[model samples]
Target: MGSVLKLYIQVAFAVKIVSCSITMVDNTTSKSPIDLSTAFLLRVDQSGQGDYKRIQEAIDAVPSNNSELFFIWIKPGIYREKVVVPVDKPFITLSGTEASDTVITWNDSGDIFESPTLTILATDFIARYLTIQNTHGNTGKAVALRVSGDKAAFYGCRITSYQDTLLDDAGRHYYSNCYIEGAVDFIFGNAASLYERCHLHSMAEESGAMMAQKRESPLENTAFIFLGGKITGVGSTFLGRAWGAYSRVVFALTYMSGVVKPEGWNDWGDSSKQRSVYYGEYKCSGPGANRSKRVTWSRSLTKDEAAPFLTKGMIGGRGWLRPSPTHFKKYQTS
Candidate 1:
């Protein structure tokens, strides 16, 4: 009898320990307002004992509303798959082993229907040192990365597609130290985006590349501002065409290649857009950057007028900006 009682006590103790551990884990993961710095690091290769080997699996494991920072450390490899970061998943950071070592790629075109390599609709997301690509070149509106998230940032990354490669669909996003390559409306969308210190490469094309389509609420004040960037194309390429009547874009201090046309804007088969579109350039240089006979509708913005659009407060707003290092570290391992 004494032995039996001792065995029962042991079983009860084990169950208690397991229950307590599960509760702790649940508390840690379910908390709202997650801190990204503390999130677990996921490695695609066998480098770490993460929850999963594939990027999509790791993303799936994260709770839809996890309020903790989650980091996916991707290994060096080319992952060809359609990845989507849905709206409910926030505070996710995807880091690569190295910019050149890790590549996430897929092939899909708008003509193909309902195919996108990566569709991002979550807020407060960051991707660094990786390449997101769509292999469908000249296939028609193939998107490499579609970002519709607020306060989303991509650094030291490469985004490649053909027609609509880098789709800044919605929100105030930032792309720095990155490379975006495409053909037609390559970098097009309705987002208030800031591309800084990046390269915009236009493939060989007859009509050239169209940069943006700002179709948003008139009061939303959406703008695409390129700072300290370069625009290069093979054939005759117009800087952009007006996709919506109130489409707004400003190219400041950019290096334009000779392939760009002087007019700097396309009609997109809509003459009414000519009246409502606002395309402007400031301090642009290069054979293609010539604005000598630019459309009368487009004007060059003064430095002062461009200041608000460049700042983080205006682009990202208040709540979307990631926490500072001090605050971020405190939240991690809490």
Candidate 2:
């Protein structure tokens, strides 16, 4: 009778393992049934224990134009490669345990579009708890990250470079609790993005600009909005420079350190843009937030003027933003 009981216990354990593989909780808020086989979960470990040894290898395994989500869990290691998520592949999440442990770094300088350490050209992409860096020093146009895709979001990530750290190109994007460090036009592009609870650090030796927003025409609904974060840096820097005639950028409910230049904004050497650019500050605190020395064109916004940029509605994030997956479908590929 004792021998029979042992065999039954082993059979029960095997059944439980099989059941767990079939279905999993959805990452989104809805309780809809997500077919586990359609999606996939891949692992990357430098120690050779996981399916793929490199992060890029795992990303390459996903089929083109995939409809379901793919999760690539990267183990703690410094991956020295220039990674790119092509425009055809979307709904991918590249995650790490923490920013300090998992690092993706490259050394490329010159040419803004071609020299990024990591380029995300796919929509509905997510990056979490990872460090993306370009160790190109104070060189020209070395971009650490370039997000040219729509509906991309980053959470708890660190992006560091000297010039053009984050090229927020055409997209409706969101960044939360991220650490972005750079010197000159570090956060530049034409994306309609909202940054929440992020830390913007400057490494300028003497003078620089944090953002260079490029909104060419007034009809184009693109702007960069910063909410609930702190801007601290090493050298004096302007909050932004008008890279286009209708460039727009706003900072609300944030803390600005003394590193911010007194002028606050630059016209990018074109006086005509000074009349068309829209730069606003609302309910900000700290030593560098004084509007007294700010440019005449910049607006100290009223509550009504600031209302439009204070929430996620600015980027229409409620419809597409997804939380980290609570459950994952187990799968492996050689």
Candidate 3:
């Protein structure tokens, strides 16, 4: 009888696993972007099994203004701490064993300028195969990650929070195959950024807000391009809202879930922005692609109009960015 019960339990567990896998692959549930067990120069493990027990310790050890690639490998575990990559520590790479297991988290929510859990101010920096989370659930303006450095990239990482999950504050940046979760203005910034082959998951918030880009004017070299991604959430979602007069955001060849609202873009209660913001789309699909209901201010770009944004050159990355080594096939990573 015991053997029979054990067999039944095993079968039920296997069925549960199968159901979860199907849901994740169908994009109904958020999945780890990818698994990359890459080598690195430094290591962090809380079990005292690596070069250091703290991520910040490993980073603080890196030479200032270092020209070479200083890789720091963090093993599987939850690291509850705020981490900052200072301006002098250039060419730093913070990697993990895998995205689903390695976590760097903190619980703090305050003003946008002071609440980031992870701040990257160093140039030529890359973070991959891990998670950065602000654990202050439903708290005000908690930032999981913020990057204000030039030539930065994120690959196969997860930035999780409720509001303001990622502050792509300012830089020439790239995000490939990462999982980002938030409810309001989660992917907001004033940067030249390209998000390729990534996954955006929204929390179970009633008010759906995503992508609040701040670009003051047309000549400002900052814009956001999201390409070949999936947008999934529990509640209604807006593609973006103009945080500045000329906020620029484009979605190209992405799949959006039904949770996205038909209106597409918001003006933050200002009617004047409707005439100035540059919100455009090209070849986006799924339930959210109902362009007829989109705001008249939003645009459906022509093939020629989208050609510039479809390339990495849109962020002036050809001179510095390199291969992503993971999900993206054609474009460079960082």
User: Candidates' TM-scores?
Assistant: 0.83, 0.89, 0.84
Q: Which stretches of candidate 3 lie over 4 Å from their true place?
A: 1-40, 323-334
Which residue window of length 10 is worst by lDDT in model 1?
14-23
| Whole-model lDDT values for every prediction | 0.72, 0.86, 0.80
- Estimate the overall C-alpha local distance difference test score of candidate 2: 0.86
For candidate 2, lDDT tens digit of each residue in 1-334? 6733533343223222232222433434323444333445677889997779988888888767777778787878999999999998898888887889889999999989999999999999999889999999985889999999999999889999999999999989999999999999999999999999999999997999999999999998899999999999897999999998999999999999999999899999999998899999999999989889999999999999999999989799998897554434544332
Ranking, lDDT, top scorer first: 2, 3, 1
Alpha-carbon lDDT of model 1? 0.72
In model 2, the worst 10-residue window by lDDT is 11-20
Question: On a 0 to 100 scale, what is the lDDT of residue 166 in model 1?
Answer: 79
Residue-level lDDT of model 3, residues 163-217, one tens digit each, is 8999999989999899999998999999999999999998845667789999998
Query: What are the per-residue Cα lDDT tens digits for candidate 1 across 104-209?
Result: 8887776422556877888888887888988987757788888888889888898887778877888889888899888878888888888888898888567775
TM-score for predicted model 2 compared with the true structure: 0.89
Clashes of 2: 0
lDDT of 2 at 269: 92
TM-score leader: 2
Displacement of the residue 137 alpha carbon in candidate 2, Å: 0.4
In terms of TM-score, which candidate is stronger, 2 or 3?
2
